[model samples]
Target: MPDTRHASISVDQFIPAPPAKVWDALTKPELLARWWAPGDVSAVVGHRFHLQMPGWGSVPCEVLEAEPYERLVYTFNTTWTLTWRLVVEGKGTRLLLEHSGFDLDDKRDRAAFERMGKGWQGTVLPRLAEVAAAEG
Candidate 1:
């Protein structure tokens, strides 16, 4: 039997902007292309997205659910699923991100998966916050 244990990494950021502002950073392909990949990289969902990282080449992403300034969910490589939720909080908005579905026995790949999770925190997400704050 294949190891199917699920692992999820999530991040929450409070951006000093409205929910719509933060939501645009997620759903807009232009904004996504800006910070979807790590520095000097780019991404385009519903089309081919090539990453500089070896063994992590072009992958297709199908947008599963998109509720405007509320939620956006999509599948990467038809295996990993990522969901982002936005909630209004006072003068800012709360952004919740979850990336799940990875192999349990593949330790080598696990590190890459974990690094992607961290990327959302260290890179992609912070830029979203900055963009939102700037628009606020």
Candidate 2:
């Protein structure tokens, strides 16, 4: 009748840089690749791309929403959705990430949810903060 599954990961981080710098680090391929996976990503809605995650293979992604220096949303591997929101705080930016749409009942998804949750919290977002703050 209806879907009743809910499993997501949220990563909120503060970067000591302007939204433009943080946005660039999120949208620009060079800067994005430096922290996250490498992809032909653009800050254009509806643009489909692939993020190459070395050992994990290439994952298809599509830009669902893009608001420069404010917000971004995309689909990861068809099912998962990654939504990023940036809020300007003084001269810095408050970065928010929501990685959703996990079918926790499925073993694979559960494993990935746990693994990626760790990855995003432990490595990905911290690196993004560094890369964004370092952007000049």
Candidate 3:
């Protein structure tokens, strides 16, 4: 049998802003485009959208769960799911991201799992922090 084991990416980041601001950067399409892909993203369960990534093109996504400034869960592309949780800290928001549904036994999935892990930490989250911290 194949390994069939699953892998996931977890990113924890601190944003020098309130939960509401960070939440906006996640939910608001315009604000989100500054950090992430451009999409008609909404914090409403069952809402379907597509994110236009430069090299990746259009990625279909659907909102699964949304709890305002606390949590947001959604399906990315097809198999992967992205979950974001926000915890209010002393002077900012602590953002926790979990990207799951990686089948390590598969070559393509394994490569994506590895690359995205670094992408989230090195580029994505840092851009999100800057967008969330900006005065609006």
Candidate 4:
């Protein structure tokens, strides 16, 4: 039996750019394709989009909150609530990512959540830094 506890993933990263630049990489579909998944994403609340997840195919998403250059929250694949909070710090921006609402009771879901956590920390964040830096 898998652990029946709820789980969440959080990551913190500092990019060598302003909040607006980071926000652009996050909100703009073109920049997002460079770093994250390719999708028709917008900075508008309630906007629905799907990202091409390589082997996983298209993952459905919906924008829940869009607060300019400060914060953006969205639903990821109808399972997790992904939140991005940007804060200007000194000469760069601090990016706080929270991917929550994992059902750890199911083994498959738990494994997927763990893999996603690693993917976010390793691939996603680094690509985002590169894109944000290039945009800056």
- Per-residue lDDT tens digits for candidate 1, residues 1-136, read 7556657788998888998878766655565555564222122334333333337666556667777788877776656877889998998899999887776556855886768777878887888888777656
Superposed by TM-score, candidate 1 places the C-alpha of residue 125 at a distance from the truth, in angstroms, of: 0.6
| Shift of residue 132 alpha carbon in model 4, Å | 0.6
Residue-pair clash count for candidate 3: 0
For model 2, the local distance difference test gives 0.91
Candidate ranking under lDDT, highest first, comes to 3, 4, 2, 1
lDDT of 4: 0.91
Q: Tell me the lDDT of model 1 at 56.
A: 67
Q: Provide the TM-score for each candidate, comma-separated.
A: 0.77, 0.93, 0.94, 0.93
Q: Provide the overall lDDT of each model, using Cα atoms, as 2-decimal numbers.
A: 0.70, 0.91, 0.94, 0.91
All candidates in order of TM-score, best leading? 3, 2, 4, 1
Cα-based lDDT at residue 32, candidate 3: 91
RMSD of 2: 1.6
lDDT of 3 by residue, 1-136 (tens): 7445887899999999999999999999999999988999999999999999887799999999999999999999888899999999998999999999998888988988979999999999999999999943
Off by over 4 Å in 4: 1-4
Q: Tell me the deviation in Å of residue 102 in model 4.
A: 1.1
lDDT digits (tens) for residues 3-69 of candidate 2: 7665899999898999999999989999989999899999898999999987769999999999999
